[model samples]
Target: MPGRYTLAKSVLSERKALHPSELERRDLPADAARAVRSLAAEISVTLDANAATAATLTDPALLHHIDTRYRELPATVHEAMRPPAGDTGVTIIGSIPLRDDELGRTPIDWQQAAAWAGHPERRCASYELDIVMLLLARCAGEPFGWQGQQAGRLVNNILPTPGKEHEQSGASSTTLLAPHTEDAFHPQRANLLMLGCLRNPDLVGTTVSSVRRVELDAAQRDQLSRPLLPILPDVSYGTDFPDAETPPIPTLSEVDGQHIFRFDPAYTPLDDADLDYRTAYARLTSELERVCIAAALEPGEVLLVDNDVVVHGRVPFSPRYDGTDRWLKRVNIRLPQRLRPAAEATETGYGQCVVAPFRTTLGIHT
Candidate 1:
């Protein structure tokens, strides 16, 4: 088995270089940006140090106590969490206050924090951030994770690492991440994905594009709705997971009038014989990039993405690796009813789901 860096190097060696100027970029609307900044300021002042401390306590009893306390948050904070009316699939809550100095430098080693059993010392400010995410997610659905993904941690760290900066994984910092749904290979992928920034000194933006924003003709939409696409597991899932030869699945489906999408351009293999599917997929990816929105999240800010409706990726940025680079904490959420039967018992209380057997031969999970 090779190291993550080796795998990243191999992948990078085969790809052509990307020019930064060719990338797409967009900012939040002025009104929405202003509202979020103001709300974050107010929440910073309202949140007490005690709340931060309570967030770090993982005891079930203590977590319950903290949950009760957060439920009593001021009306203003609650209102800020709600997105403005419309069909936008991505929500940005910026300028939330974080005591970065107290949190110290970015971690050089990922294993310490990426483990299923979390690191206590790393929770200083991220713990409070996760509490906010948990509350927001509870309003819509339950948060979850996979035991085989990012060590099955509820709050996974997103940052650039030494050798993985060019890989398609979230740890990559210098590579263009092809837009895709989070863990699209799974049947029970998250309904919502939440990202909380801890340190983004360079102001790197996360790219997001929604299905609602992408214009498609009736024929194209119909083509995409057919079961003709095969999505592979993310590199982070390691190579040992099973079911790699599963049948092709639909990229888009309508359930109760709501559209659901599963896509990963980097991982999904193209079938030259299926001309219609290939053409439709190409158009879909192009539309997604055309309407892509880049949100530069700052410390204390959180971005909530409707994974079922939109695909997301990050812009390429150089990593200094000086322990002051970009850093974020991520979590996945799914409605309880959406939890698959096979993963229910294992993922219920704890977010750890059973990894499928597909693509287990890659030995990348290590």
Candidate 2:
């Protein structure tokens, strides 16, 4: 059988050969788009008046207020924004109005943004995008994030940094990001992943594959359902944490009668001794590649992915060290009831798991 790295490279090669034209695309209705823009504009004004920073904007109290306001949107707007039903496992909302000039000029220095208290201009753009994501997330479920990841920021900036662009991370530009579930190593992975594009001058496409689109036989399905896969944490979650690995969990499981997946090819290690598991894993990877779709999100466009049903990645693209590069803000969402006990304390605020010994290992006698 082929090694995991070989399978990953094969899939990436196939994905790279395809263009965005081959995949499906959807635009928001004009009326719905207008409503969203109007709402975003109103929220921007409020944020500006309050002198909201990223930290303040994501405050639990402020989030509640935003959620309440979103609920009050016209019923027609909500209806129009409803995602189409199918196996795609994604919804693309386009034509949102973002007044870049008013927000602020794009920052050229990533290190400066990291060092400064905050980038006022970039913060404004993030604030506007966050409102849109929060509205959409509330419609689907509650939005959340991890304190361990992305410095506990609710709105994560995904842009290529000078030193990190070639690495395999969200901030990596030249590397082909392997398709995986966001935070797959964590049991409290979000039910929905929201990405709002602030800028994409190069028009890079995001690759997505849905489990619903794969054809699995009973044997393959049963093999994958067994708790034989061990997933490791992504590097985004700083290295200071313990090296504990996840308890053996199935890559695929049925939740509420719907097929759900927990897979990260880069992090999930395969058991060399288990032939059935290895064969099933390879077959699943191939199927994902066969049905994969690419989406090139534009400025003012947001993509909502059903986290449980789909795996997503990014295609490699050249990034100019200049200010104009692909920039996106991401937020993870889950139903309030689905909040894990370990993360409860942080869930109401900037979501983070504060407790130590964070991972639960399987098969340990303890």
Candidate 3:
């Protein structure tokens, strides 16, 4: 049984977008989605009249309560997150409970949403959906946010910003969000990325490509593992460093017979690499593009990507910015463990820290 990530090769090509019908769909139990929605509505936790701001969202009490309160989600949800034999890493869980008026209009920008601290009415519409993302994220890992990105709010809002349609960040709509490992530059980047669609009136597709789907010769793998490239932070984080002074990191690595990867061609200074290394890197990039799959997530659908195994991006599209434009909520998650022991090292990318609101008791036997 092929998961959504294991779609037919005919559906993929360079910059080719997949129609929504071609992307496989899986639905969570209706009862479970409804129950979670109801549970979120009853939440009374607040700090200074804010229910879902950075401080309240990261509160340890609320995070633990939600995880423990409804730990037994359907098997489909857990199964969708795990890659079968690690062949692919993108999984879509759809049909969570949502209503148009309940979410209200999408926020103008992430900053506008952050300004809702003293106004409960503005944040009320999407509060439940944010909680729902937390509820789903705990099934695989602990949800976290970047201190530099969105001021460390656990859940992030992803929507197109006016006048930024051609930029490389998530706010760009007309420009293809280049394929990259989420937070590839940071040593403590997330182990999994969860994107939950709140409003996608245009059926815009999110592209995904996994390392497991490609084959590299031993020579090529060795070259890729030599820490020859340095990935810089995307512009969305509002951080920058002298590229030459930054330490190089591996585009691919192997540990205990398993593969770990870091890749961000847009941020990686390819001109700095030698001819042989660049050739190998070029091959890897070509293979990834050949296997890339574009899947459009419908409203209430959540896509979970294994950060180590997949590089995800978005296709270029025109944004209406008319309240119904494509909107998504993203969560960065930390798994129980990492492939590299050095993952524990603090290389604070631009002084940004993790905003973990909860102490997670995730099973770490993997």
Candidate 4:
């Protein structure tokens, strides 16, 4: 399989350099810029440390620290939530003191929050909700504010069982989320993903990402472009399983002539035994996995994945079901309507209209 790449050899580094105007507009104060650079440096170091760790994605101690620290912030708690974003695509509102008085209601057992049937009451009644805010919050901005469903949706949770019937959506322990774009079903997609760690998993669950800068070659790019790969709707893509299944959507699309992958290695099914598309799928997967990099985040650590330029996943973890289980407060956000236009919002075939089916494929459908 051949590979395809842009003239830019260092894609990720190039994107990291914000245009002077972009920096000024985002109000990236000198101190904030310095802080972001420092954080990035620290992350780079952490990535190096992970080189010696197991590859399965279990890392609880780091998660524990993140949970403990974010629990310290109080002001950011609300009945609804939206990720806070800055020039760096993420912000930390540590230990937000979210007490019952803040929401005029009694707080429930947030430590083990059951999936709400519909709109669950805001968790702000009481308890310190460790929130990690992000600039690019959701695929499509929801109807209400950032606190609404579309932006601040919680995807992974600490399930009672690991990959069992009860815990199919998430692993009982710290498990790596496979690399894929967030809300691939939404047309108005967010270019970024903000992950906030609230409770540390008993084991490791580092975030793994594949950098396009290092992955994909010209031939691979051409292969990805050849066939309209089908994206089967996964039941895990939704909260409650839908009655009927939808048709398979394309796995790749050209956005303004740029190659973008709507990759879901788990859910994307291809019978590539045949020569044409099957071979292409095989090459696509290999290239994507080749340049994968992992980042294990500590508790209170907010990690942002550039969705457009990178594919992200998680490492496996051990779920102890202890009180201090791994928990993350997730908030998704996208640029306001005033920023990017709607045509740029979604891929032509896959993602639904902007903000229509609040949640994408919830469960893996057969």
Candidate 5:
């Protein structure tokens, strides 16, 4: 994995696609942003005094305490953040009242961020902002983390590493990140992805394409609905699930008359798929590109993507790595308490597990 990259495929057609300007009124209203800051400031004091440890931050009791404060937000904010319906499933919330100078420098990589909580002296200045993200995620679902990703931090930082600019993971910089599900391979993948901006000096775009916006013929749709391919782990999680009966992943499924899809071409084993299935997958990829739009976020803004209804990626940008480059904090959210029943006979846990210690507290069943 080199530090520089060029995308292997194009994510948009020759006709210029929509930019952040095209994404209408998803920004958080000024009044709501003020309310959010007041709430976060009050909670940050409580967390600093009592949280004591990072693990305690995820404790159910604390979460409940924090969640209760969500009522302080404007009712209009609640209505706006409702589970997306019949739309692009992409929401860009701006105006969170952040201080640019307090953000410090973006970490060189996620690995460095993993150690921030342990050493208070090296603590991230974005803890207040992180609390804002946690509060916002609760409006929709429970925020969660993986066993091996970013040392299992509930809120992970998205930044470019000098040595990982060409990888398929979030650390990539110069390479174009093709839109895909947050974690398509696993059945317990996030239903929603919350990306909050701390800084984006160069105005890097976070690309998003929803399944609802894609176009496909009847036959192609049918083929993809039936295609079952294994999307392996990306470089971020270097683990192998050696299960003899691992169920294959279907790129698309319809539930209650709505289409839901999980696609990650970079990790998918397309070579193992049948020619008909491969052809359909390629078509789906193109369709996603056709509808893909880039939401170039700035400081104090956040982007929430429906992981089930949309696939997301990052556009190529040069990272200075000088502490002032683009930086965003990310969180994985699980909505719909009990997950959809496994698509097959076996439990499709896929050998990976979540670190959501408060699942029971949140009324989520395994």
Candidate 6:
């Protein structure tokens, strides 16, 4: 029932519709849909067996894949990436070079890519990006999703988009990024974030991440797991505009004795019960400073971050206002078996959020 949904009688009965993005307006084209189905089938076979019902769930094969492919990074590099001595919440595998066959190139802009949505991978190095997502999901033992527009640039190309960008230079003018999760507004969020660097700006823009180190004592663990902390989203991230009124979700959620975390200091609102909020915040900052490593990824190098356990940020990137600028591609995925449904199935119930749209809408009428 938690993953089920009831269908609305008709379009008129549907609640107010949220404005869909230009990309969302056009659902996956036939070929893309077929590709996704194939991918899904592959995932179902690899995962789905002995998955966790509530808390931590992982497939043995998935772990083995991560351990094996992780060797792509040098032993020294991987060892250097361990989240400090006391840290355990996050693990970062850096600068894993993909096979030459695994790499693809993107078009100069989004318009060209959209015209051939049916062959998305053909549009813009998307096939390579897809492989990156697959690897990350396989590592996290979680299913993931492709996020935003495949070929879209991080910043608006024509006019600078929101969240303050250097006007003349077209670079990030600010140094400090407000801490926040990638897509808190969406119920169906990406489980992992894969960043592939196409260019670097002034050799800056180092990534910063915070994690609740595993060595915390019982008291610290309790503090990390304290109930009902408000998670406020940065206004720039999305329209939800989270505030104090939004009930707090767990920053650290556990199941089957395995702990998982979803934290964004910028968006996470504080409640009275959050006694160690400041301490946790301070410790995280210290850990990030001490453990943060930078990889000036070449065109073919990709970095994968565990989203559920790691909060990521970027140091300021100074743009030169030239065609050559810092560029990175991101993709997200979800492990369906790890997710819990909001409610139980009724006589007529909607499925999980990802599939619920089919229940009330004219089944992919788009």
lDDT per residue, candidate 5, 1-366, as tens digits? Answer: 111222236645323232444454466678888887777767665654332344224645456656687777787667766665546778776668888787777789876665553345555456566677777887767778888787667888889999888778899998887777888877777888988888988777788788887788998888888747666666788745554534676788765565668788777666667888878888888878877777777788778788878888888888898889888899888875534434632445566678884354332232
Q: Against the true structure, whose TM-score is highest?
A: 5
Please provide, for model 4 over 1-366, each residue's C-alpha lDDT reduced to its tens digit, 9 standing for 90 to 100: 001111101121111111222111112234433343243233323432231121111234323333233332222232023332332222332322222233332112322342221222432211113112311122123211121232233332333343442221343233335556665544455554556554453434433344344445566556665544344333343433232433344455554454455665544445432465566666655655655444434444545545544565555555554445455544334434223222332334233333322233311111
Candidate 6 lDDT, tens digit per residue, 326-355? 555554544444442231111011111331
Clashes of each: 12, 1, 1, 65, 0, 26
lDDT on C-alpha atoms for all candidate structures = 0.60, 0.64, 0.71, 0.37, 0.71, 0.38
Evaluation by TM-score, superior candidate among 2 and 6: 2
Q: Report the Cα lDDT for candidate 3.
A: 0.71
In model 5, pairs of residues that clash are: none
Candidate 5 accuracy as TM-score: 0.87
lDDT of 1 by residue, 322-366 (tens): 878888888676654432332212222222254221112211111
Q: Model 4 misses residue 105 by how many Å?
A: 20
| Residue 138 alpha-carbon offset, candidate 5, angstroms | 0.6
Candidate closer to the true structure by TM-score (higher is better), 1 or 4: 1
TM-score of candidate 6 relative to the true fold: 0.51
Model 1 off-target regions past 4 Å? 1-59, 83-85, 114-123, 241-245, 336-366
Ranking by lDDT: 5, 3, 2, 1, 6, 4
lDDT tens readout by residue for model 2, 1-366 = 113323245445524432354344456667777776577658766653343344434554456556678876656556534543557778776667765554344444333333231445445555666667667666656566566765555556777877666555787878888898988766667767888887877678888889988988999999998877566566676433233433566787764466668888776667442888788888999999888887778787878787878999998888787666777778777644432333222222212362211123211111
Tell me which of candidates 1 and 5 scores higher on lDDT.
Answer: 5
How do the residues 1-366 of candidate 3 rate in per-residue lDDT, one tens digit apiece? 112111112223334443334344556677766766766665534323344443337665666566675466656666555532335677677668777776666767887766553256766656666777787777777777877887777888889999888766888898778788999887667888999988887778899888988878989988898877677777787544664446788888766677778988777777778988988888888888877888877788888788877999898888886787888999888876555535325344646567775535432222
* lDDT winner between candidates 2 and 6: 2
